[model samples]
Target: MAAPAHTFTHDGIAFGGDYNPEQWHPSVWEEDVALMREAGVDLVAINIFGWAAVEPRSGEFTFASLDRVIELLHAAGIRVNLGTGTASPPAWLTLAHPEILPIAEDGTTRYPGGRQAWCPSSPAFRTAALSLVRAVAERFGSHPAVALWHVSNELGCHNALCYCDQSAAAFRRWLRARYNSIDALNAAWGTAFWSQTYSDWDEILPPRAALSARNPGQALDFHRFSSDELLDYYRAEAAVIRDLSDVPVTTNFMVAAHIENMDYWQWAGEMDVVANDHYLDYRLGDPRTELSFAADLSRGLALGSPWLLMEHSTGAVNWQPINFAKSPGQMLRNSLTHVARGADAVCFFQWRASLQGSEKFHSAMLPHAGTDSELWREVVELGAILSKLDEVAGSRVVADIALVFSWESWWAADAESRPSTAIGYLDQVHAVYAAFAALHMTMDVVAPGADLSEYKLVVVPGLHLVRNEEAAIINDWIADGGTALVTFFSGIVDENDRVWAGGYTGPFRDALGVAVEEFAPLAPDSRVSLDSGATGTKWSERMRVTTAEVVDAFADGPAAGSPAITRNRWGSGNAWYLSTLLEPEEYRSLALQLAAEAGVDSPVRVSGDAEGAVEVVRRRGDLASYVFAINHSNTSVQLQVSGTELITGDNNAGHNTAGHNTAGDNTVATVEVPPGAVRIIREESAS
Candidate 1:
């Protein structure tokens, strides 16, 4: 449990990034502040990795250096998002209590060379870590410059899973609390098979390395337990901060690529503001499509309330195999694209580049080239743009489509020994989402069992694990005139990791009006043909349609001439099922057809020629609406809109159609967006 959600205290559209003054001399701190002021940086994050500096020894206290840094920002009228600075524990404390170190899943100890090297369930580490948290909160809790309290830096980033004795005990304790007794635990874990039955709670252990294969139920429960442990840790820290300060508190969520340990659906309610750190992942088919999905996911976590973009890179990140810098205007589009979704604030991972560290290569607001660099100039330009769009703060993006996402499902479906290694949980998710994005549609990434009544359309893909009640929610909604699209390989297992009885689709089979006889996952580099002239890759299914209309059939594959896609008229609305992965363009065609059937339209549509090259979204408040046009193409895009463009502060002058202005407002006119540019139009209030 956490404190009731508090207010986001920063002024309109807070802008800044992580600032580390300790990495440089006292002389350099002044220059950093001056440059920050020049770039319109108002809110700065400081002391993210200050555990070693704040408390050099176990009990010693030192705030002299941090105090000076904060003082300089305060004097310049900049606010602070104070970090608890417990990201990494000091060397002395870990050396004294070696048991606090984390053990890998293979039973190897993890030393302190990297960040977050301690066990999440270790008592010694918690005590030392919380003491440092308390000290920092007590000292800076009342400072006027401190508006937000940033908890640890990206919790559960590296050491989410631990297999030490201490962690094993904690896992057992968590299980006990959930199942209540040894008998119940044994039943839930399905230990009656494989001679693995347990008579006492003490006999159970964390699912460590096994010879053949571990129990599926036990592995799933351990994942649940690990996520709960981190949530418990965050609750403890939040409790401490609320006891000491009145400012809002948050921890940066890695909602971006490759890190999916923590179940943020369970963690979002504990936060006052849902802040996320995103870096463009070039490994995906298209990074921009994934970016839109991630941003919508963050907005969903915030429940459509304005959230924060805690950290993004200015150009490129250091960690990817091949680091690539953004093009000339890529940073601007990236930052504003997040804003267009639902971010009230725009921030980055760093304010200045590091001279000596592992992340020194990461891009920053002030790069090594100093003021003369284009990156620095763009940072200043972004700040100015944010300042001009002050009225856009607190507005929320509206979406009629819901895409269901689950961290637990990702863990279970992507576990070892699935039907195919050619396809992954995220691969299908990103595929479907990119299809919608290409149509310039905005979707709210939702969780299963969430209220689907508010949405006109819902998309559920690759959901391998679901509760009975969660499936019921979707079925009930579909019967009430809400259009639903459920893809293949979903609803296979229940919460206990047991197969659902009737068919592969489980509880959803009746709603979708289709059931799978068996899975026909294709081999590597294999492709199949569809009757609709679309190509299917990576996956195919052998299924029979019962009470449905066949939309497409497999022309040639393992299940030749079978139904590939079907639509069923359930009660008041419709339910559609797609049993194979379609190529990108074909997927988009299917998705657009469904969206049109559901009567869900984009906020503003682009011309046919610029359909896939431009994205438009609207943020609406009671008094006004802001339309954001992002041009990803190299040619100019002209959109029909009626308002004053905020970026250039020009009214619709010559682009207005004659006699369209008779109603006395800036008539619907063509707004020419330059190649690789953005235009925000402030229009009249919503009726």
Candidate 2:
């Protein structure tokens, strides 16, 4: 498979990260730039939070501080990713137009002390923000240092939803454009049941706090509008940047596990290049798996294009309750893992640790201890490593398996009045994704509506809201010999969050050859075993088989002997319906079995003699295939593969160290990958 298309203004993988030189004095700028060059920092993201510094007052702009920083970096031969600094409006703008402030659902307005305090729907905020963007672009658009235009810092980070009158008015306008009329809005929002029918367009309001339960359809639409509102904000800034500068534009996406509201798949189309900021949640989940999930999702948003790792912490982040620092070598491993997943640029949150303000404690390349710190040494070492691995840039991970993940379904399923509140959309999806990861499989976390024909196996887990057109796409893909595994609570609602009248799993009932009679939500203490030895918890559905054969039955439960797992052949393809959430091992077994049935395997498979500790990922470039052997366990792993180690000089005997088929025959070799280390090898072909 060919790699996805990407535009690179720089030749090699760009490093360095958010550099707030304005925070420090002008005297510190020279030393900072010198240190960055010594550490192999080629790129620095600047002006991210410089709204107040650039434009101190209304209708006035000054770029002396920013100009000095840019010049210093440019003189040092370090490229700049110019940020628009529109994410946080200046204090004067907010004070002049207080209406631009975002109001919470509880009717409290957010002040300008914190960032992202402006309402996305506020016209004044948009005008002010665009004016600043235009000013900045006009000033530095053609500058030799400016390589990329960062639209805004993580758009809609805090002000995703605004319940104020301005937002309500904007929401009504958006609804008018979408539904066209009040009657259409009423129908789409299902307002008749609650006697909440709208008589006039002015009668409609933003889904705010109410004494009674809010409309799910209204909330869903609000979610869509909020996401679009932020996208519009990004587009507005990007439009100005494009008009003034030919540089590529991007906004850092917070694709962390906790990010909600914004639909990145739709937002990806508006960006010149996709960039993501991922922060690991050490308190809740394993950092490695979370990083893998975020990076894969980001790459998928770019359509397998080499995206930017815009922001990540070198160690502890200040915002989390427990700011745990990374151990030795953890940061390097984290950076390499992102590269293995398709991130061309590996960057961090900031270059230097803050001495004051909220993020003073957050770790950075230059920590509080400066050059004397071990973190600083590690940062220099990682910079050296990235400088050497330039050959791996722009390569794409080749995967025959695709996991369909949707933010819309995540919102709908998590909405109130569901089959079970315990049904986490990502949790279900992650269980399946983790199983694939354990098997060293390279899978893309694609959108539900993306092109699926390229993938041999597609897994859709907990897709609660299935639009008619999306269902048709999946059904057509299955009929065309594509293997699909869809789980419970899927195909329940339509595009407007309305349930199909006949039964659950509306559009999927016919496709899966099974009809869900009712949802049997298991208690926390409850358990059910499948005939396939898969124990299910949290959820199970009672279904009656129609044209499908039962692959697994509920061994014991309220729905005992019912079809828990069914398989049906449609046209030339097959569809598997997992009616319950299975354990990781069982899910892995089922996933592997289905993959084998579909004739899908990882690009590089480990020998059977070794346990599955080292994970392998293959990315194909124009010249060769890049294989990443990552040891995630605490012990060493022996990996036998046909490739040349790109980082380390060591290679197994009897194999071509040049990574070419010199004798017209392939050679196999075994090497021990140490725990928590990564080995990137280059093979001639992906096969």
Candidate 3:
């Protein structure tokens, strides 16, 4: 793959993670440093929660211990990513300024039991946070070892919507900025339907249970407003840090964190580099579903910029009722998956496990047993491997397909009472994603307003909340000969979750050439067969083709004979409507068929006999392309390669049962991979 437009140099994939030396005695500091060296640790992110220690009272400051930690790491040749200790507030500040504690939506003030309990919109919290941030930056901004500045650890607030008076005032201001005038706001919110129109901004408050009815429009706006408010808080802290520090600043974001409405695209603009904390449930079929999705999201957020794997557990997390170890090769495979996706570096949640506090049981490189544990050995081995694979750092993945995933539309759709209670926003989108994954097709998950001209095919599934401008963009794309595949429950509502009144799909009715008169919710076990000899699973929408050709319909329902799939030709493009939820096989077959028609290339075609766990991603460049063939299963499987394996430092002469043989060695080889193995091959020539 071609290197990114901007080159960032790191010795190798960044190792080491949240390192807190404050809990340990000074005598153990030497041991910690030695252990880090043994494990090939190079970067140490320090002082993530030292607000109380840094400033005990209003303006009192002390940095004696912190200064020593910095000096020690610097002298040891270790890079530092300094953190502003603003995630937690001192007890005194919370006690004196009770407003600093977040107020729940139910009008209850939260007690300080956990981290991330501070109210984002609270002026008192912001003031105290800024004081400590400015102090930390001034002291360590120019430190020779510091490479980056981490602001506020994991900025997701537990109490997402603060119904406090301060938040109430902010919500009003946010609404004004969005609508510009009360008349437009009234129309957008459909306030005329329920006598809910606002005469003045002062009268508006957050859509709390006490002041509002269960209106989807009201609820949707509140979500948008709350997200904006939290973003403002993040920006406030970042502004203070940037003023005092020359180093790049960033904070860890949870990828699927929906309540925050933090447009990763917008958030990435303020950050020097994007970072995220990803945790997975092994039972969720395949970790690749969530892992690859997040990586794509992060890459898109950075506009193809590399991201940081901020946190992953070295062992099992105690928080989950049943703490399970990442079975043998699981951790290694998961970590490599991140690097393969586009992460510049990989790090875990902690270096040493804490002896006290809620996260004490969390996994670490140096476990509670001190050292010499299996977990520690694995960490060391992985770190050694990263030291060797430094060339892959800063490489980019070139993709031809883009999947449209709009957070705003997702939030708005779920906010309303839809036709099917079973039709969840994430699940519907994941269905389409699962189809693409099953076909082993590389897809770029993009936001609403991303440039679509580069992509030959775009798949938009269940786009229920079509904001005003989005329709025009889609229309233009279709008019320009772009092929778009849209599924059921699309183009039903505007930005605020209000039903588009002109027709079922207001602005898109003509483009789709279909009118959805009624929607039918399917039972959990219900099934429907399409006229194209394809079966559908769960949920179907009944609609008529106004100007398009119907290819399929429901086998049974009140509107059983109605169109289930439609195809229309607009300008130079073709628009397809999937009026019902499709079975996995059906969705995959249709997606691949459409992709073929659009002239998009499908790389890495695995034969039927090839089994066990496997994944493939292609990275293209002007001159040549690189294909990554990874075997995530326990047993080996055969694979065809046209070039060499970068990881094993081998040359591929031909397929072997034991996998590709190494250079300068004569060994019979088959693509027989052991559990959790990876291979990187560069295409001999571009297609």
Best candidate, lDDT-wise?
Answer: 1
Candidate 2's TM-score: 0.95
RMSD of 2: 3.2
What would the TM-score be for candidate 3 when compared with the true structure? 0.92
**Per-residue accuracy of model 3 over 1-687 as CA lDDT, tens digit each:** 212222224676788788898888988888888888888888888989888888888899999989988888888888888889988888888889988787776788888878777777788888888888889988988888988788888775465667788888877788888989988888877788777888888887776665544667767888777766766777787777777766777788777523335555556666678787777655454556767777777777767767888887777876666777787766777787777777878888899999999889888878888766778888888888778666666667767778887777777666635566666777777778777766667778777767788888888877788876877787788889888888877788877677888667677788888898887767877777777778776667667888888878877765589888888888888888887778777887888878887887556555334342476677654555666666766666555446556666666623433433444455443343445776666666654
**Residues 573-637 of candidate 2: C-alpha lDDT, one tens digit per residue:** 89999988888778889889889988887766554333465568888898888788877667766
Worst lDDT window (10 residues) for model 1?
653-662
RMSD (Å) per prediction = 2.4, 3.2, 4.1
| Model 2 residue 572 lDDT score | 87
Global lDDT of each candidate = 0.88, 0.85, 0.75
Better of 1 and 3 by lDDT: 1
Q: Which scores better on lDDT, 2 or 3? A: 2
Instruction: Please give the TM-score that candidate 1 achieves against the real structure.
Output: 0.97
| Predicted model with the maximum TM-score | 1
The segments of candidate 1 whose C-alpha lies over 4 angstroms from its true place after superposition are 1-3, 653-668, 685-687
Give the total clashing residue pairs for model 2: 0
